[model samples]
Target: MAQVLEFKLPDLGEGLTEAEIVRWLVEVGDVVAVDQPVVEVETAKAMVDIPCPYAGVVTARFGEEGTELPVGAPLLTVAVGAPAAGGPAAGPREGTAGGAAGSAATSGGTTEGSGNVLVGYGTSEAPSRRRRVRPAAPVRPQAAGPAPATAPTGPDRTGARNGNHEGPVPVISPLVRRLAREHGLDLRELHGSGPDGLILRADVEYALRAASVQERAAKAPAVTPAPAPPAHAKAAPEGIRTPLKGIRGAVADKLSRSRREIPDATCWVDADATELMRARAAMNAAGGPKISLLALLARICTAALARFPELNSMVDMEAREIVQLDHVHLGFAAQTERGLVVPVVRDAHARDAESLTAEFARLTEAARAGTLTPAELTGGTFTLNNYGVFGVDGSTPIINHPEAAMLGVGRIIPKPWVHEGELAVRQVVELSLTFDHRVCDGGTAGGFLRYVADCVEQPAVLLRTL
Candidate 1:
């Protein structure tokens, strides 16, 4: 009889029920080596490529692209000798049970074609299936130097650093990968507590938050109540309120959580935007598309992040941690026909004003057309919401969830002001920055807003900061 070996989709991480297929790297009949890239999967948090562990000829794809497959479901089947009659194994494989893995090895004996499959990953339960059992203890390699004393001692692998391992291996699903990438976490370093060492999305989130807290102690100063907003009459409701269903819906949830969970402290600064307006007009005269005050604000925000790193941070409420980011992925609120959208500008600190303006244009157009993907909407460190576009003076804007702060930009209008002890008309814009009181103090928020104002009033100041 011909023997066949089946490859089931392992539980990429703990608590990862399902994953969406993004792309397939291999085709049917292609000879793949162990650890070769075979498929790409997308979870809620990130995209990860799965490598093949056993070398064999490609057989068949589990389903079409974008298909959501449950954990332990057979993804592909490869024949070791003569091909088997049935399709890929259905349900969790014998040793690969996610929920109750300890009982799998003894219950199902290894068959002739079955290879040593890692248990504790997910697999379907079927009567005909056999379990390939390995040694009780996993063989871990030693490092060249003495192991760090701070290594966590636990059954969970999250805290365990894997800087030593190499080679292809089966792992958790897309959601776990996404969570790890967003929080700048290392999945390999994490010692998973889930069945068979599968890292769960929640596990990654917990690790990230723990890391963030350590950073906050190093950055944040003593917290103080933010200065109160200037008293004004109940502002008449003039703007439209649209329902946020998709991208906007996500934004709403994030902001609501930030406000409800974290203590918010807001501060204000007035900036003379005359120089930025003149600079923009000159650029437009040189054949560039006319950039708005909001675009100029984006450039200033990016520059500010480079000068003050603490402003670009995220607060983990559950972990009681704060993570300061080095890169600036500036997110600006774009009001479109659909609703309010904040398309992110990746690595904002790396791009120049011209390049930043161009990128905003592209993202805005894409967002308005309803073509932005999930990746585009993820990974924002700081956000800018422009109420000026609709001709408002200013209001304390809510912070985006996860992030610690958001800058609100108001309209630039000619106003009477004293310059050098003389009353004159000057172009002025109100800037408000609302930050999580738990993560940042009043002094830090004030300093950050002042820096942004200075950059706006003198656009050339960015030359040194950028």
Candidate 2:
């Protein structure tokens, strides 16, 4: 006798409320062990594998690949109990529900539960047996009900409208409910397009738009004339439409918000990086582990930030104050097939060039593989953008939102410049700093950029801070 249990999508931390199914690891009727990954889902931050807490035969699955499900939505159902003799176990027999429940309670082979606290399951231990209660008999319309001319069919509609719905409202996000309330729309009047009739934000928005159009039509005159297109004009062909979702969508939102909210300023300078290149070569020639050019630049950025702490801070709009951070959690932009992700190297100020190089390499590999966790993708204090790899000479990078500043580095190329008094071919690179104007004025921004340029011109300048 097997007791069926339902497992819902768990919260994958970092304030993520929904995830798109990437792949399914288990199939219906397959036996799964406790803590086994059942499906891989892509959230806004990263791709994650969700584990099943129950060990049993998978009875049913909820969503197909690429289907997006909200947190607390049913992912699958598992039939738990001992396997039947000499064959795959079967579902519980009808009318033996009580007997099977009792048997499962006393069964020695059954697992108590997997003590895992993910999104759906809490920290509490798993219950020994699921409580089964007899459902009330369905209410049938009276034989004389044919006399009524106006009776509603299907699931109760007036429950949500009258605010007396007993069961769950099918809506997942609070933001969706808020949107409906603000527009004076009733959630009950809408049909959800999601799985199991779950209400979504788009559904609410569409209802609001429809309601607005209806209201305008009722108030306006119906006999208005319309204008026609010119005979010389031609209809446009439809283009391929790509959905703005997942990582690309997240990037779009963040960049748009930064442009809308932050008052930013950009300053750039070309520096003779020949000395820095030579110093890096010399260090590699005598070192156990080779130091990377990015690491050296990162070290310089940290030193520059130490001198001008205002750049290493964020503006707290709610607090109406600038929050200056003591420690530097440095973030570097890495481009992958998925998209551009800035992986943060925590406590970067305390790390030496070698350590920073190693950490950068590790994070870059993780980013390319799409295995970087949500924690690795957030909590950045200041960002260092190395656009040099893209073969670009200069760019005014949009500051990563909330972070006060971002340092952009361009490709180092050999250019004719004055060495001492005479002309010489020297390695030169363009450095740009994009800062939040609200945090500091141009003077402070110029000083910070100047220090970085100085370090590039003479690597020894960084030794003073070291």
Candidate 3:
């Protein structure tokens, strides 16, 4: 007898709560194998194919392409084993119990299957479905249930009423907590709209906007606040209004968060790269595998990090401590058609130039194809951004947040430079280092930048550490 089972959209890690249906690989009545990819989804992190855990005939698909679904929403239903005489599960999808999209009427006992879903996510046990509750006015949510849409408004029912409650706030995403902390919003004072009273980014943002509006309203009588310019103040310009979602939205949120939370500063220096370029050429000329210029710069970065360990650390605000990482996982900025992504090269401090070049190549290719996993996309200790490909001379790079520093490399072009007391057309490059002021001061930043410049001016300087 066939036992029907349902597959929910599994959690794609890195704190992603939702994904948009990019493409569907299977249709109803299609036979699929265990661990077969059933759908392609675009999360804020990347585009990935989601494999199903169960091996069965697809009985129904839930959401259509382009539908943005929260994590754990029903994806499809499958009919396992041989069919019953009437074959009740062979028909089109019907609504499931509790208003979930797909039918669960034919669902029986749990069936064991492979749990591989994504790199860091697995889907064996069913996850709870997420629902957005739009209460009349948000009530201080309890961990047990959601507030009704007709929740009471006014100070009497404000979240501050539960401020005295002794329990940890229900927040699963670190990003959401960070966003709230940046704005000085108390999590206990905001009602979460996620499942089981879980706090989400949207909830924090909404609360901040509401607070902003109220602040202006409160000051309206004291002063002529909330400007209403002359009748014709020029309507806001409008063009194509693209919804910020997927990778683009993720980048926007992260960059904004970084600017909000981090006190960062930049220092740049111009260097004679004649010897560095010549060194790379020499290595290639005598080579097993050609080393990339980026790899050489990366080697210099790792060596400098060893000398100035403060630049290889992150500031832990809550713990009031500086975490100096022993190993470097170097991330390089990659621009692809999808968007800009940073793929980290693990144990970068230990690897030689050849290994770094190969890993960078592989990760870059994966990033361009939108196939890089969540683990590959995160856990960067430092970043190396080569903006030279754009033919630019320099830029004050924005430090990638949480990480203490970033090294920016500009065009290594032929310029008239004074070398050994003589002016000549020599290869020159500009290097910029942006560091978090909380982690290190200007002196340390300067020393790190100077070390990198020294390595570029004289390649033998790196050999001392090598």
Q: Tell me each candidate's TM-score.
A: 0.51, 0.74, 0.71
Which 10 consecutive residues of model 1 have the lowest summed lDDT?
Answer: 106-115
Count the clashes in each prediction.
19, 2, 0
| Model 2 segments more than 4 A misplaced | 83-237
Between candidates 1 and 3, which one is better according to lDDT?
Answer: 3
**How many residue-pair clashes does candidate 2 contain?**
2
| Best-performing candidate as measured by TM-score | 2
lDDT of each: 0.64, 0.75, 0.73
For model 2, residues 307-372, the per-residue Cα lDDT tens digits are 999999999999999999999999999999989999999999999999999999999998998878
Sorted by lDDT (best first), the order is 2, 3, 1
Q: Report the candidate with higher TM-score, 1 versus 3.
A: 3
Query: What digit string (tens of lDDT, one per residue) describes model 3 on residues 260-292?
Result: 888999999999999888888999999599899
Pairs that clash in candidate 3: none
Measured by TM-score, how close is model 1 to the native structure? 0.51
Report residue 56 deviation for candidate 1 (angstroms). Answer: 27
Error of 2 at 78 (Å): 1.7
